[model samples]
Target chain A: MSSSKLHPLYKQLLRAFTSRPSDLKTSGRLLAELKVVLIETGLIFPQTDYSTQDLVIAREILEIGAFWSIRTKAMPSFDRYFSQLQTFYNDYSSILPHSEREFPIRGLNLIRLLIQNRIADFHTTLESLPLPADELIANPFIRHPVNLERWLMEGSYSKVWNAREEAPAEEYKFFVDSLMGTIRNEIASCEEAAYESLPLKDAATLLFFRSQSEVLDFAKQRGWLIDLTRGVITFTQKGEEKLEIPKEKLIANNLAYARELEQIV
Target chain B: MADVEMKDAKSKSDAKDDIATPPLSPVSEIKSNVTLIERAVSTLEPRFTIRVLRSLTALRKRLDDKALCDAISEIYPQDSQVRSSLLSWLPASPTQDESMEVDPSPSPKTPSETVPETEIYFRLLILHHLLASPSTYSEAINLANETVQKIQSLNRRSLDPIAARVWFALERAYELGGELSDARHLFLAAQRTASLRHDDETQASLINRLLRSYLHYSLYDQADKLISKTNFPTSAPNSQYARYHYYLGRIKAVQLDYTAAHTNLQQAIRRAPAPKLAPGFYQAVHKLFVVVELLMGDIPERSLFRHPVLEKALRGYFDIVKGELPVSYSVRTGSLSQFQTTLSAHAVSFESDRTYSLVARLRQNVIKTGIRRLSLSYSRISLRDICVKLHLDSEEDAEYIVGKAIRDGVIEGRIVHEKGWMECGGQKTGYGPEVSEMFSRRIGYCLELHNQSVKAMRYPLNAHRKDIVDAEGAREREKELAKGIQKGEIDEEDAMGGDF
Candidate 1:
């Protein structure tokens, strides 16, 4: 209702929430413009006397900014917006959007931390939730991150990857995809070390790539040689010398496995 | 008319014979002598009254104030003409100058100066004054100080009884004015003098009074030290013993020793003066008893709520605990918010009665109850379900509560961390050590109840009236039988057939 009388910068920033940024360039441009307007109003410095509507609008813009940073895989930018949202919630929660909007972003923020392998920070974030885990998980937004964390801890890569499709909000999908990407790379590295080579089709599925071209690009980055006629990718030796494996560790692993087998009996 | 005349003649001759014969012990001698004064005062003869009053005045210097007051009160009640003459020695109300004139040595004298009989009577009067009109507390304290000064100046070793009583009055004044520290300080000083004189009654009563002050101010360490350092009397006046147990109960309750606290509180309730005589002390002990029972994780007996005196005070807790919207319902149904509201409603009353700590434990009780119900409903419930049911924040918190419950023997279960499940061991059965211990405690309680009832029973010849002793015994037996059936020690069908 007060849309017409809002500051010009506030109006422009409001666009971020109304429409999703089409590409990284547009998102980056909109974020830069937001930063300039926020600085000019001294809002970045926490200027006083902003109306409740203004604070609400500012919180919405920051929420979108957080999603953009996650989508672009920029963690520091995401942290900045998330912390600002936290301040807004702490100070102006009465005027800001409902908890429904806030919890999903927090959930996505947790996914980003998981993807970045910040286990300690992930737990710290989970600990900060005011709601109990049971009540918290009842909300789809909050449950998405919690389930992701549990699945990741279980080392269930497939479950973590499948979780992307079930994200509660559109912005959550960005971080879920990022988490899957990290899981895929982790599996790729383990596969490379465990085996000399694998067929292209197996490699594509293992890497969670829908097409061979994506897997091919990834293989190039890992310095693997592809034989299109043979339908196989070959691992290249790094140096002109033989690499020795640690026999002690292999024996330790075997001993542990044997103890576990004895326990099963 | 002839029979009444003969009965009066026989009573008078018996009284004369009792006095003519000296008693075996000094206690019996004094008892018979006091009764002689009572008989003489009833004749309304001026000569007999004067003779008895003079003898009592001489004996007052040697006897305890309590016995002197009791004997003299027979001739002169507080408002009598003789009592007014005794009051001429008190420093208040323009009597100080006249009393000073009688002290021929106007200048300060040492212990040898005549220890007036009226000085002991003055302290007695001051104690009565303080007890009746609380506004005179400061004035009473000032008078006590002056008397202590005079007694110390007299410097007589045998006047310790007089000094002890003066300090007792001072302590009562300090306690009345809410100056607990001063009261305790006076108690220590008086105890030293009373003990040195080997005055057992005064010292025992003083310790009982001091323990109550310690409890009121929550000076638990001081109370514990006094109990340990002092040689308690094997027997004392019933009122003093009752107070001793009541304060001991409060101290133990503060220390969270509910078992010992329960024993002491029950004793206090039993030994307390009748409700008509000291309702305040009687009701206070009863309230604390209820709290101790609750802390022990056992519901108070329903009969406790039926007392005309205790019903009004205990109704709130009874309603929240056993009435509609019971705390158990909240826990079993996961209605934490409702439980919280109920607790807060009674918080003020609980704080005033000093049962706030025990009542605050209700939250943990509710949570444990929720976990136990969950265990019964599902053999293996995920930590998430426990969290939901207990309104806990996380699986880790639920795990911690469940782990504590298992350790405390409130529940039997193992937590599987990897699977995040609490695998309940179902309900433990068989005559294990825990069951045997429980059985022993129940038997101990039943025996204690039986012993108390026996001690509490009235004469069998008077059994025509409503016998509280019989009723309490029947109630306890019913409770024991019900518990036996619940524990499966007695089959219900067998109980019915056996009864039939």
Candidate 2:
């Protein structure tokens, strides 16, 4: 805020500062981001406006992101920030952002949103979204150069008078999650383009996707994954179907393949 | 102005000792000799430039080849203060000639008699700097062991404002090296020095350090004992006192006296007032509180314990000790993380298969002193049991380890823990456990050191009467001051005098 050409760290603070009317290029783009955030998480609610009381929760989450972005951007070690990404998931948003009041965009809420979108045929399971691995290098989770920098200057803080970097483990986790989420989206988009209409649902995670049957089962527990058991489960048929962009399209591609063939049979 | 100078002397620990004696050490002589050698090796003996090359030379020659370091330790300066201060930083490897690497212990300014005021703490600080670097453990342990042994050789009282600092540094080294007993002993010893200076600010600062070492060593009794010694918020202002309470909170928290732990820890946070106390402490404490709360499931946050800082402080402190943070910053700000990392690294590099030999001393002390009141204390756990656990070659090695434990006050019985359990000195009344636990170790130690047990044991419980008398005397004195205030004999400004 003090200097123009805001630092990446200040971007979090800036994002939090302008919570009501978020600067997401467009509200549509912002919702797209939010929808993805929701899909990955299992928020308790399908939708909660970040206009009133929820705004405070959103701001805190954003501030926490900014704080870690500041620290992560300064570190030099990639592994260190990666390790911290696990902690970020557990500490910051694994549970709902409920100090006194619950924010709807918590872990389960996000998961639920994805489930709803997937049911309605939203874009695709976010995991399948295309993302650039290089973009991930900038994602705080992978950007360990900042941590290495901090490590390099471990004794630097004391040798000179300077403000210590904030290291709230919880807040740090939030930053890692957001960055990783962004990276995941980036990678998902890339993989989506690469694996267009694959037989498997998690074609983006193609290497790890189990047989078509296993993917269907895993999708059942995690409704965010589509169930294309035999494509007979489709709500629309053939080219007449207009997809509404599901929050999660995990099972769709695999399930669609299985279902499309089964429907023909 | 002269009055101001004399008044400041009230808190200067060295003022009294400086009037008396001044004797430099054999180590200092060796140090200066080493300086000469370093000067020969490279013109700049103490520079990082010189050190890198010298450390390489020493490494090539392998200084651990023989008793070179032990000889160097003995050959250090002759003045007790200089010798002890320098020795306190000597490497633990008796074979390591650390001076061979560093040479002439560079003072920021050259050393001189009437010891140029600045150079007084210079060596202790350098030792601290070495410890704070992300060095290996063998080097750190070697450094730490030498540090304390050398400091012991000095007349601590004679150390300037620097002496208190020297002791503080020594305590940190001891703590990091896992010499908990020695650390607590030195910490208490520092407290005594702080009290002698009558400098409450310095005393209070040291008190917090002492309290943390007490917790780490699991010396809850001593920490608890300390609480009754001074009133809360009296030693320093609310902020400083809050830190003190936070440390005590940590002790209680670690001890698992949840009710009391919460009460005090919360008050600590409330009183700390400053956020820079490092919220990590609050977070750690809060997490612990949350843990206890979850464990209890329905327990309410007790009053006076609602705000916790110890957990946060602990998180911060642990990361520091673990070398999760960089060593450079910790060196200046005074985190002992570098020392622990170095010590651990030392154990791994040289000793191999064991990275905890130094820490065994803390266990050894507990085994010897048997201070079970500290909670889950090793002292009550039995030596035979520990021998089996630690895998000593024989009971003698176990006993040797226990002797170190006795030094930690971690265990009980001096002779039983000491190697020569059979030998009886002139005043040895029955070295065996004939009496209660309280009188055993403290009494035996007094007799061993003083040889006048009859009078010493005559008041075995505590010098409580003296303590009461002191308190009563203070209350009576304060009443007179109150009366003076009432009578307008003392001005309001006078009553509220003294800067914090």
lDDT of 2 by residue, A68-137 (tens): 3333443223223233332223334424443321211122222222323221111111111122323322
What lDDT would each prediction earn against the true structure? 0.62, 0.39
Docking class of 2: incorrect
- TM-score winner among the candidates? 1
Candidate 1 per-residue lDDT, tens place, B131-225, comes to 43454567666666666656545654334334445655666777676775666666677677767867665677778767777666555656777
Residue B276's lDDT within candidate 2 is 44
TM-scores across all candidates?
0.44, 0.25
Model 2 C-alpha lDDT per residue in residues B1-500, reported as the tens digit of each score: 75457335532533343344245232243244344433433432223222322232222221221223343335444332444334444444443334334433333232332232222333443445454433333455555445444434443332323343444555566556666564555556656755765655446666777776655433455576787795443535464577676666555544435467666767776775445445655554454443333222222233313345443333322332333122222212222334345444444331221112212112222222222221133224444654454334455344334433333333333333222231211233443333333453454454445533333444423569889999999999889988988999898786788311
Q: Using DockQ, give the best candidate's number.
A: 1
Which residue segments of model 2 deviate by more than 4 Å? Answer: A1-265, B1-117, B134-168, B199-202, B217-219, B229-243, B250-260, B271-279, B291-500
Ten-residue region with minimum lDDT total, candidate 2 chain A: A120-129
Clashing pairs in 1: A132-B393, A133-B393, B111-B154, B111-B155
Worst 10 residues of 1 chain A by lDDT: A1-10
